[model samples]
Target: MSDSDLIKLYSKQILALATEIPHLGTLEDAEGEAKARSPLCGSTVTVGLALADGKVSRFAQNVKACALGQASAAVLGKVVIGLDRTTLQQGRDALHAMLTKNGPVPSAPFDGYEVLLPARDFKNRHASILLPFDATLNAIDAS
Candidate 1:
């Protein structure tokens, strides 16, 4: 697709993803939790995680952000629900690679993350897209 077409398509996908935001659980009985805020944009995310046998048993989030941040949280909510710690870390690494290193397009299961590919072109939005995952990783590390 042309650059403009790609941008339009990603914008539509981002908006569609945003609609899933309301489905994200805002609370969890987690072993640990972490909150992150972007003072530049006032976007904030709180990640709550439960651990069982050294694995992630539950994960949820509370987020107050713009469309980009909300959509990223929604995407995270879906894929992160059942992941183990290693996989979760891998996902975070994959996302970082996609966002910062022009890595390969995320494969199936995580193909939904492809919708965020456009975010790379817009640097200011990077933090918004990464915020939820960052908080989740922080929480997981602390757990």
Candidate 2:
């Protein structure tokens, strides 16, 4: 495969998501907050959330990473609202499998993770791709 093919991993769709981050701010009154960094690439993601009725009521993030990390943040932002810990954990597990174990895409709500399939072949990108979900879980645990 050519270098162009490797570069193509960041498709237009993924770039769109990356550049147009959805929940792209901080929640001052967040109940929990956590940040994750990829030591290999120096990519970072900080997530904050407030829970209501045991589900996500508000969510926000600051992402400093590549297009793949930004896209993952966008996908997480889109579906995080109203989600519970169980649902989030399932998504995280599925995402891990998809990237490392050749498993299917994450289930609904997180099914959008399919947009990241091309990234699976690039192991170096895996930690950045997983940052949003990991930060979210860390925040949840901290709360």
Candidate 3:
């Protein structure tokens, strides 16, 4: 990647988001918990959650990843409190398509993911970027 590409991928907004990750710890009584790692970058995220009325009732995460991954987690952290499994799955699918197939940004609540659009060209970073969503979804399943 060129300097210009790096600049685009790590814009001030992305960097700001990266530093503001929320729910940054584990939950002792969580109903589900899961972790995802990006082999290409060795980035990882762990998610712990509890569900009520078939929706996420509580959530937390430990994000140890690149700026791209952190930004993704920041977005998810800000919006995941009330989502259900289907919504999280769709967000993951949409984010995947956006990165790999030039698809649209994920829908609202998750739309904050648009900050990661520039990452579409960085295949190796895709896994890390998707870590939060993957871990959360897996955590839901593990519940």
* Candidate 1 residue-wise lDDT, 64-106, digit = tens: 8888898888887877765667776777778778989998656
- Candidate 2 structure quality by residue, lDDT tens digits, 80-142: 999999899999899999999999999899999999998888899999999998999999988
Q: What is the alpha-carbon lDDT for the whole of candidate 2?
A: 0.92
Estimate, for each residue in 40-114, the C-alpha lDDT of model 3 and write its tens digit.
999999999999998999999999999999999999999999899999999899999999999999889889998
Spell out the clash pairs found in candidate 3. none
Ranking by TM-score: 3, 2, 1
Report how far off residue 6 is in candidate 2 (Å).
3.0
Candidate 1 regions with alpha-carbon error over 4 angstroms: 1-10, 22-25
For residue 24, give model 2's deviation from the true position in Å.
0.8
TM-score of 2: 0.95
Per-residue lDDT value at 137 in model 2: 90
For model 2, the stretches where C-alpha displacement exceeds 4 angstroms are: none
Best by lDDT: 3
lDDT of 2 at 47: 88
Score each candidate by Cα lDDT: 0.78, 0.92, 0.94
**Clash pairs for candidate 1:** none
- Which stretches in model 3 have alpha-carbon errors above 4 Å? none
